[model samples]
Target: MEDSPRSQELLSLEAIYPDAELDITSYSGTITISIHSADPVGISFAAVPNTQPLYDSINYLPPLKFFFQLPETYPDTPPTVALLSLWLPEATLTALHASLLLIWDDFRDMVVFLMVDHLQEQAFVLFGLDPPIALTEVQFEFFVSYNREQLQEEFDTQSFTCEICQQYKKGKSCLRIELCRHIFCKACLLEYFSTCITAGDIEKVHCPDYECTKRVAEERKRMADPKTFITSGTSTRDMILRVVFTPPLSLDFLSFLPPEIVTRFQTLFTRDQYEFFKSNFPNRAVNCPVEACGHGIIRDDVNDDLVVCPKCRYAFCIHCTNSWHGKSMCRLAVRLDIPEDVLEQYLSYPELSKDRRDLEDYYGKFKLRRAADAWHMDVLFKEMMANELMTACPSCGVVSAKMDGCNKMTCHLCKTPFCYLCGEFLDRARPYDHFNDPVSECYRRLFEGMLGTEEELMRPIAPGFAL
Candidate 1:
């Protein structure tokens, strides 16, 4: 027995689209045709009226489904076709339906294949709409998500060679880095990144492919500015900026790693970024004074000592590291009044030693610990101020800090010239001669302790100063 024309058409479609659902007996089925373009197509979405549209580029769109029932008359009578899509407008669907009917009317033969071919080729330019198909916010979101899902699905069904292991693997067993689109087996990525995170090598957490890493590094170097340089010293501000700016790896690939490893990666990456920001912008960056909230705060006004921590909203004076004292002299000279000798002796003993215990008992543990904490904080405050903030004038012994400029400094009180780096008195007639002299340690090091220089600031910070 020979098959009917309708059955033959259905069989041919079934062969072409193996995944399509078809009923040979009923001569009815649904088939999906994916839209593809040689170049990426632009899509724009207007979230609200009178606003510019958000734009994105993609190479794929959601598949268009064709539902058909072959009539007994078949090619002579054309199959009934209905077009359906998640993202296409109703009017576009109606137009597509009319186009399919025209194709059948002109061909008067098996036109399903022709319709599918026309859709595949013309989808991007359908209705003569130019690039950047305009869509509503909801439709845009739906199309993007659907497109991504389709791409992922397609990837998962294929096989690739992982560069890391040099082994062929199914896409489901591999992980793709979103930034570089490099693929590696999940097991290899897990082991390699986990080791890096555990060893505190946050920089190695990026794509392991040599060419990819080199390209990324070159790009980063090209984008490098003074702000990207990190110093050796670590601080609370450094950590905060790191956490905010430099994530360890893309979150998509991080899922392949253990939770602990992911956490470690984040910690190390943040710490690294924090160190860089702290090193490059010492004067502009200060740690929040709150004991429990030491977030980094970068200042906009160099003269204003007032700082408000973004993390804790604790407003404080940068110089005093105390609660904000608006328009008033910093009261940093105030101390906890613990006897120096007692505080020294208490600190010399090991924390758990009997000597420390005996001192704790004699001074009363709570009182002694409180005094010790205050003393330690004062010492830290002094160190930070000296190392990063202020320098004492060599002639009058007046303490001051330069917001920015060359190494040559002048005493505001005595009007004596000096070198800010070594605090040595400069020749009155030739103050810069000190730095220009090759024999002088400060020679050619005027910018030392600034963003790019390797040398630390050399200003002498007095042990005691009145504010």
Candidate 2:
């Protein structure tokens, strides 16, 4: 039988795409491309998520199955295109069809191979998979955009080589830090975290950005205070990708770790939370220093300066933060002396050195020593501050000295506004209301007789909104 033009065109297509299997029915034929092909033109996932792109991977992308129906006027008109990826929103399929049509219209004749290559190369991008531009009126457009995000989830399930340990791993077995998005396999991360936790490097549990790690020596030499150093002079933010304290994995994923590891992690995490509370709420729970006593004594009253460790039966004074001296004065409190190593580490300038004897000689003669009872006086001062007057900012340790402004006060250095009485951060909006209520800890004490007038201090928060 003499071949129809459509059949002849189908034969040409089959010749070009040998793997494309054709289902030749009386009405139409469908050619399926069920394998990977080079599509440098196509965009992958829309917004690169908090995960690395599966690198040097080609074995796992799903196949592209499509249908093409020929018109009676074979070489004179374009074939009708239909995609069969059912999970794709209809608008995506429709948008794809429209894109193909544009290519078909450009030729308007015998463009089968051209159309197929376009489909292979551009289908991923044209499928409405980019971050959606909002189009609210048309529900189909909105859904197509909403559903496009699912493509990332599908892409994540594939396997990729973890940069650390240089091993291929399934996506599920890898953890990606949010801001940095560095991929670390399960075994490598668990091992590293185990070693760090065992050594009590709790606060240092962070993304192992090597630049920051390598610069630790230099960072040390440049700063005196390691704990308070915010911006590194040498290692800029980009070198670290993200300089933050958030762990790569959430508490929900803690089950992936062994129970022993979990316990160790919880020990450090609990200590951090306790320290946070202690700094902000000094009289709430006092940490006892006796080794293995392992308990916090609750301070029910603001005036309670003496803490008796319930477990160890060791008594300590809150003001001096030391062993109790009943009638004898508590010794003076000295500023915490930062060690040289810690200073160098904070400065990121490990090579720096100072002439200690020269500095000692210079400072020693200029400064006259006060009475040895200075710490004793500080103890009494602390007792009054904790019991009657103020709280300190947890971040900067700035003491509350509000005389007149609203109960909410912002730390000048850290800019963290906290309550003078509770030392808790005030809601940025309705700060004044915190003291107005009768049940509040600092109630009716908004005006500490320093700055604001009676009306400003007593101004009530408006309904539904805070200023």
Output the number of the TM-score-best candidate. Answer: 1
Candidate 2 lDDT (Cα, whole model)?
A: 0.56
Which residue runs of candidate 2 sit more than 4 Å off their true CA positions?
1-22, 25-66, 71-73, 76-78, 83-109, 118-132, 135-178, 181-185, 197-201, 212-248, 251-271, 274-277, 280-467
* Ten-residue region with minimum lDDT total, candidate 1: 223-232
**Model 1, residue 309: what's the lDDT?**
85
Candidate 1: segments with Cα more than 4 A from true spot: 124-127, 215-224, 227-244, 298-304, 327-467
**Which is the leading candidate under lDDT?**
1
Mind giving the per-residue lDDT tens digits that candidate 1 earns over 1-467? 14877777777887888998898767888888777665878899878788888998777777788888878788999889898887777888888899989999998998887887777666756545576988878878877887778678888999999997899999989877777788999889878888888888777778898887787577445323333333236553454344435563666559777888777776777667656655644555578878898776665443455788889998887667878878665665233344878787888889899778755533445446766877877687678566645778876778777655677788889999888878889899888888789999988867765543444335433345322
Compared with the true structure, what per-residue lDDT tens digits does model 2 show for residues 385-466? Answer: 7564556786799776554456668888888867776777676777777778798887876764334466545655323223
lDDT of 2 at 464: 29
Per-model TM-score, in order, reads 0.63, 0.36
In angstroms, the error of model 1 at 211 is: 3.9
Candidate 1 — what's its lDDT? 0.73
lDDT of each: 0.73, 0.56
